[model samples]
Target: MLDSLSLDEFGLWAWWIIAAVLGILELIVPGIFFIWLAAAAAVVALVAMAVDIPLTLQVALFAVLSVIAVWTSRRYFARHEVPSDHPLLNQRARTYVGRNYTLELAIRNGRGKIRIGDTLWLVEGPDLPAGATVHVTGVDDDVLKVEAVH
Candidate 1:
């Protein structure tokens, strides 16, 4: 069936179909990467329709455009990182930093547990007794590093 179509017609259809497939893949995967490739393919489709370029040149143009699109996206994202008022919003333990809490469990050998907002957090700090006031200083994985408030 494809033998009936000329090179330009085939190139146009091929690029457009590839573009559509890439676009759908981008939606399914949600990586924000394939959309650029789809755009490049669509641009090539337009070029293929308007020009009678050789197949090799068309492939080269598509590759170049895709690379440029990906590079530009990377650079743009690098310069414009997503900024938020709460950088630690997703880090539940980090959010406790600088907050004072009473130790529910005594620190034996620099480890203890504290109750904060109905959650028990494992903490590391200088040895202290239960009921001692401690301030969260940093977070290490699921554990919080704390210091005596006094």
Candidate 2:
């Protein structure tokens, strides 16, 4: 039975390979799904090499460790995550702060036209030049409100 499998060639090696693949995939996908599984697989491989554990035991260990790592990360996010108080995080999800915008229409009173990102927005603030840098403040409905930065 053992003759059929070589060292680090059985599921132990599979675990390590799967773990590495998952870890790399985690970077591309970036939602923290396979990262834990990868870690668990690595541990399983280490244990299999050091203790000569059976393939079945190695697989079981991988499953348990994967669950533990993923669940532990979920718990951390649930416990430590806090909702942002900024109105824009929900209200104006498309707007970004510190972004430079150009005023397309000068403000006569408190109304002006500015281009933010790829979309043009109607802003309300002090009178600004037609091509002045503006920072997005907040949004109402689909219209973005901005203020002249300089």
- What is the TM-score of candidate 1? 0.72
Candidate 2: tens digits of C-alpha lDDT, residues 1-150: 777865356444676777788889989995768888888888887887789777777778888898899899999988997677774566453555446678888976888887656766777778887988788777666656677785
lDDT of each: 0.92, 0.75
lDDT leader: 1
Pull out the clashing pairs in model 1.
none
Off by over 4 Å in 2: 1-12, 82-150
Q: In candidate 1, what are the lDDT values of residues 21-125, reduced to their tens digit? A: 999999999568999999999998899889988888988999999999999999999999979888878798988888999999999999999998888999999
